[model samples]
Target: MRWSSWVLFAAGIATGANAASLTQVTENFGPNPRNVGFYIYVPDKLAVNPPILVNPHWCHGNAQVCYTGSQFATLASQYGFIVIYPDSPNTADKCWDVSSNATLKHDAAR
Candidate 1:
């Protein structure tokens, strides 16, 4: 089956169920020079070594708004995967620093 069709089928299975909301991660994972906000959504039934889905918000968008407005949380619940929503540190424009090479390199923000 097509990937899109499979997702739709899975989402349909838990139509009335309440998916878990995103939770802010307080503990530091590592150096965050950009001061980006981290949020996560863990499904009730998690798959072994589940793949992570990073859902970064668009310009002028925050983690909470993206979580509530998108299907990532619901899909995570249905598919038993983890979802991460990272809030950009660029408060001036509320956008990610994609133009900078430092931000693009692996663990460059540190």
Candidate 2:
């Protein structure tokens, strides 16, 4: 799937329930040239090969803000799925690098 599409999918889930705190993952999953922060919310109970939800925060926001301010984590807990919060590498404004060529390309040097 495209990188930009996950935002819409995450917005469609139900909200307003309490969830566990987000966990920061230091393990390198791939070539993170931009050094984006990876935070995940894995429920106490997980389904078999459960689906994942990538929840990115808005401008001036980070993974912690997105995780605590949204219902994706709560939904993940209730529905047995995983929620991944990808933080922007940009430290100034904290917005994603949507204008970059690498970001526009799929399976690029991520």
Candidate 3:
């Protein structure tokens, strides 16, 4: 795996899933910025109320390009609950910050 791939792999592990399984597809969703992705699946028969995330795909990749949001849904759903993945922006350091660093927290007050 490449250096960045490892980082993505680690994210999959951190999410507590055994492995990452993903595919590429275009999905229709609410007003979401470009790069958003999701893999809707039937909730697992076992889970009553599964956990979710604010921006699951924020740091993850596209299907398999970076992270496996589709696979994540497959697993997360099989385990019960809903999984809504968001596409995070890709920027330097693998993070999104169109504005300069000095503008991240407070450029107005300065």
Of 1 and 3, the candidate ahead on TM-score is 1
Q: Count the backbone clashes (under 3 Å) in each candidate.
A: 0, 1, 1
- C-alpha lDDT score of every prediction, in listed order: 0.71, 0.71, 0.39
**Greater-TM-score candidate between 1 and 2:** 2
TM-score of each: 0.74, 0.75, 0.34
Model 3 whole-model lDDT (C-alpha atoms):
0.39
lDDT of 1 by residue, 1-110 (tens): 55334333333332325336566765545555678887777777867666678899999999999999999888887888877788887879889887786878966653
- Candidate 2's residue-wise lDDT over 1-110, tens digit each? 34434322332222213234476666445455678887777776767776888899999999999888998878987898878898898999999888766899866764
Off by over 4 Å in 1: 1-19, 105-110
Question: What local lDDT score does residue 56 receive in model 1, on the 0 to 100 scale?
Answer: 93
Candidate 2 vs. true structure, TM-score = 0.75
Can you write out model 3's per-residue Cα lDDT over 41-101, one digit (the tens) per residue? 2342425444553234333243233234245555665675434343444543344444765
| Candidate 2 error regions (>4 Å) | 1-20, 106-110
